[model samples]
Target: MYTIFHAVFGYFFMLLAVRVLVRRPGGQLTPFEFVIIFLIGGIAILSTIGHDPSVTNCTCAVIAVGMVHRFVAMARTRWRRLGRWMDGLPLVLLRDGQWQLDAMEGMRIEPDDVMAAAREQGLTSFSDVKYAVVERTGSISIIKR
Candidate 1:
């Protein structure tokens, strides 16, 4: 029915919006980012259900959305390019103690962020780090020298 169509559309729309809006992974989301996500999800749910308050309509919408999500996940797995497009490749923030300024800027990362990650890995000095990468999952990885 219309609910199913709305659910599929809303799912894709939200998927695209979240991919564009959220650069960091779920664990690293800021409070403001979390608020944004919640608000967006609420809006998507409202729009998808439209004026339907019936349990059947709600159940159907949920199932449609879940099936669409599962299909996309499977498609991404089968198609490497789709997976790469959905989840970007890892970025090198630092290599051999040298900062990749352009990559850092593009990713909105800073030396302090890299240093914080290094600190978490028990690296006190920049010289003690050999590589720093912004993983596709939006986690900063530090490699010791």
Candidate 2:
């Protein structure tokens, strides 16, 4: 009874926090990002499971959360606006050696981050960068001139 209710409510809160806070994909997790991820999981566990520590309660919560994620994914495909809102549009941070400072600040990105991405793509300098985009997945993509 209360177990089922806790599962649904706890899962919903965890899911909402994830959507709002986590910006990068798994592969791109920096040390700071990794810490944040672990902290979020720890807190979510304390929150979602409460003090039960029962396998049945945990499994129910997992299943409920998984189903909600699946539904959101399916709906995202069917509704473009919802998709855009859930996952923001990509932002261009640099173009032709010029910086889009406002966009970088809005995304909490710095020039050095873009330069590091450009370096990954074998670009030596900003002059060689045709464009730098912060993709919706939170990875920087650099286009070379």
Q: What is candidate 1's lDDT per residue for 1-145, written digit by digit as tens?
A: 9999999999888878987776684747879788989999999888888888899999999899999999999999999999887878889999986899999988888799899899999989899999999888888999899
Q: Candidate 1: where is the Cα deviation over 4 Å?
A: none
TM-score for each candidate, following the candidate numbering? 0.92, 0.87
Model 1 TM-score on a 0 to 1 scale: 0.92
Best by lDDT: 1
- For candidate 1, the per-residue lDDT at 117 reads 93
Q: How many residue pairs clash in each candidate?
A: 0, 0
lDDT of 1 at 133: 93
Per-model lDDT: 0.88, 0.80
Which residue pairs show backbone clashes in model 2? Answer: none
Which segments of candidate 2 are over 4 A away from where they belong? 1-12, 25-27
lDDT of residue 140 for candidate 2: 93
